[model samples]
Target: MNILITGATSGIGKELALQLTSKGHKVGLMGRRTERLQELKDEIGDIAFIRTLDVTNHEKAEEVYNSLIDEMGGMDVMILNAGIGRIQMLPPWEAESKLIEVNALAFAHGCHFAMDYFRNRESGHIVGMSSMAALLAHHRAAAYTASKHFISNYMKGYRQKAKRMNADITITEIRPGYVWTEMTERAKGMFWVAPVEKAVSQMVTGIEKRKNYVYVTKRWQLLAWVAKLVPEWVWDRL
Candidate 1:
């Protein structure tokens, strides 16, 4: 399959590229870091197409997506993996706004584009990188959590739309717990942190199965169930 992965420069995106390419799939890589993109292209060779552009740049991103699809002859999947956490402390509004733009807005754009393409062709797979935070909120990362919630709800709507359109479009939302990537290496209070490879391997399997919602590493489902079962008053204390 021909797949395009955003944020392919590092972490899960990079690992996905390596694994998928090793499986003989053509991958189109996009990220803001030119050097990192080049490195991936070099390592993945001819089957990898690299493009440097922020996912927030919607126009350019669409163009690059199409260009890569052309290069690969066709596109079968779009992985909206580009995302950022509240990794640094900034002014409240600034941090929240940035997270909204990259994680929520940009992700919505990718979904919109992929749905359009797939609807035309009547088949495609869209993999969105959501988080367990979609079910729980953090006071320190309110916007980040809220954004993921939006992704979950929004993707649900799109799923209905796919059914309405009668298109063979699969929208898979990945709600992952802590995974030991650069993103979570320094995170405090993390438990059951799956190795990046193991986490992404499950992700690939879930994506291949075209599951609507995937809780990475499987054990995360216990936490997800707990989150749903816990009383709101108890969570208010946390």
Candidate 2:
């Protein structure tokens, strides 16, 4: 299958690219880092196409998506994996705006573009990258959590619309907990971090199976469910 993945320069995105390309799937890799994109293209051989585009740039994102769709002869799946997380120590108003811009607005635009394309074709899959933080509010990462919650809920709504229309489209929301990526390396308890390969593997399998929602790690799914059942007062004490 042909797949287009954003934020393919590093972490789960990079691992997914490598794994998918090795399995003989055509991959269109999108990222802000041209150097890393070129390196991945080199490593993956001719089946990999690299696009140096930022998800935050709406016009560039649309152009790149069109070009990738044309290059791949139409995409079977689009993975919305580009995201930024900021642990703000200041007041919520200060950092909240940028967080919404990157994690929420950019993601929403990507989803809109991809969905339009897929709806026209009447067949496609969308995999959205949300976080387990969406299920529980974090003190320093309020904006990040809020943005993820937005995406998660948005995908859920989209799923309902797709079902009603009988569109041959699948939308998967991935909620991952702590991952061992550069962004989360400075986080405490590195030992508990989920391996990038394992997470990507599970994601690929879930996407292939057309699962509606998945937590990259089994433990995270359990935690999210448990968090939902916990009393508000008890959760506040954590």
Candidate 3:
């Protein structure tokens, strides 16, 4: 598969590029960091292509994605993994709004672009990197959690759209629990945090299986089940 991954500089995105390319897949990598993307391209050699792109830059992102697809010949999957996480509300609306831009709006931009590209071809996969926070919102990370909720819900809607369109477009929503990545290295009260490589391995498996929803590390599936049983009053109190 020829796959394009946004935010491929570090964390799960970087790991996904390495792992997928190791399995003989061509990977188109995009990130804000040129040096890191170069390192990945060097490491992966002919199978890896690098583009410096900030996914929030909508116009540039579209150009970058199309350019990579042109370079790769074709793209089989688009992983919308570019996102931001905020653990506080101290700075108020500005920081929160930026989180919305990257996590929600940029994600939507990627999704819309990928859907258009795939629909024309009649077959493709779209992966969205959401979080367990999508199920259980946190007070300290209100914007971050809500943004993930948007990701998951938006993907669900697209899944339905794909069905109605009768296309072979797979929309996979990855809801992962705490994994020790650059994004969550300083996060407090973390538990059952899977290694980034391990998490991405499970994610790769899920993507290959064409699963609609994947909970990384397997144990997180139990949490997802419990979350649905929690009452609104309980969540409101938390």
Candidate 4:
């Protein structure tokens, strides 16, 4: 299968690209770091194509998708894995809105683009990387949590719309608890940190099974459900 992954420079996106390419799948890697992209291309040999792109740039992102589709002949899957997470302890009003732009708006655009392509071909998969944080409000990372919630909700709506239209496109939302990626490397003492390889392996399995919603670790699923049962006061205490 031919796959296009955004934010392919680091963390889960990079790990997914490596895993997929090693499995002999054609991969189109999209990221802003040309150096890392070139390194990946060299390491992965000819099956991997690198596109230096910033997902937040709507025009560039659209162009990259079209170019990749043309270059690869066609894409079987599009993974909207590009995201940013930062601890924002300030008032919500003072937080930078770029988190929303990157995590939510960029993902929405990718979903729309992928849906258009898949709708035309009448077959394809759209995978969005949300976080378990979407299940609850986080005090220090309000924007990040909100963005993830938006992603999860957006994918849910897309799934419903696709079902109603009888579209062949399958939308999968992956909610990971905590993975040992560069983004979370600084988060020490977090026992929930699953190795990147482990997380990606589970994610790949879920994708192959066409699971609509998946938690990378099974424990995350239980935690998400438990979080929902917690009262606002109890949640705030965490």
Compared with the true structure, what per-residue lDDT tens digits does model 2 show for residues 71-162? 98879999999987784575667678877988899999999998888899988999999988888776766788889999999899888888
* Whole-model lDDT per candidate: 0.91, 0.87, 0.93, 0.88
For every candidate in turn, the CA RMSD to the true structure comes to 1.1, 1.9, 1.3, 2.0
* lDDT-best of 1 and 2: 1
Instruction: Give the per-residue lDDT of model 1 (tens digit) for 1-238.
Output: 9999999999999999999998899999999999999999999999999889898989998898888889888889999999998847787788789889999999999999999999999999989999999998878779999999989988999998998886899999999999998888778999888999999999999988999999998999999989999988887899
Candidate 3 lDDT over residue span 1-238, tens digit each: 9999999999999999999998999999999999999998999999999899988999998998999999999999999999888736547888999999999999999999999999999999999999999997878888999999999999999999999875799999999998889989988899999999999999999999999999998999998999999998898897
Candidate number with the higher TM-score (3 or 4): 3
The positional error of residue 57 in candidate 4, measured at the CA in angstroms, is: 1.2
Where's the lowest-lDDT run of ten residues in candidate 3? 83-92
Mark the 10 consecutive residues where model 1 has the least summed lDDT.
87-96
**Sort by lDDT, top down from the best:** 3, 1, 4, 2
> After aligning candidate 2 to the native by TM-score, how far in Å is the CA of 208 from where it should be?
1.0
TM-score of 3: 0.97
**What is the RMSD, in Å, between candidate 3 and the native fold over all Cα?**
1.3
**What tens-digit string does per-residue lDDT give for candidate 4 at 88-181?**
5755654548778889898899999998888888888999999898888877778888899999999999998888764688999999988999
Model 2 bad stretches (over 4 Å): 87-94, 189-191
234: Cα error in model 3, Å: 1.4
- The superposed Cα distance between candidate 1 and the true structure at residue 18, in angstroms, equals 0.7
Per-residue error (Å), model 3, residue 80:
0.6
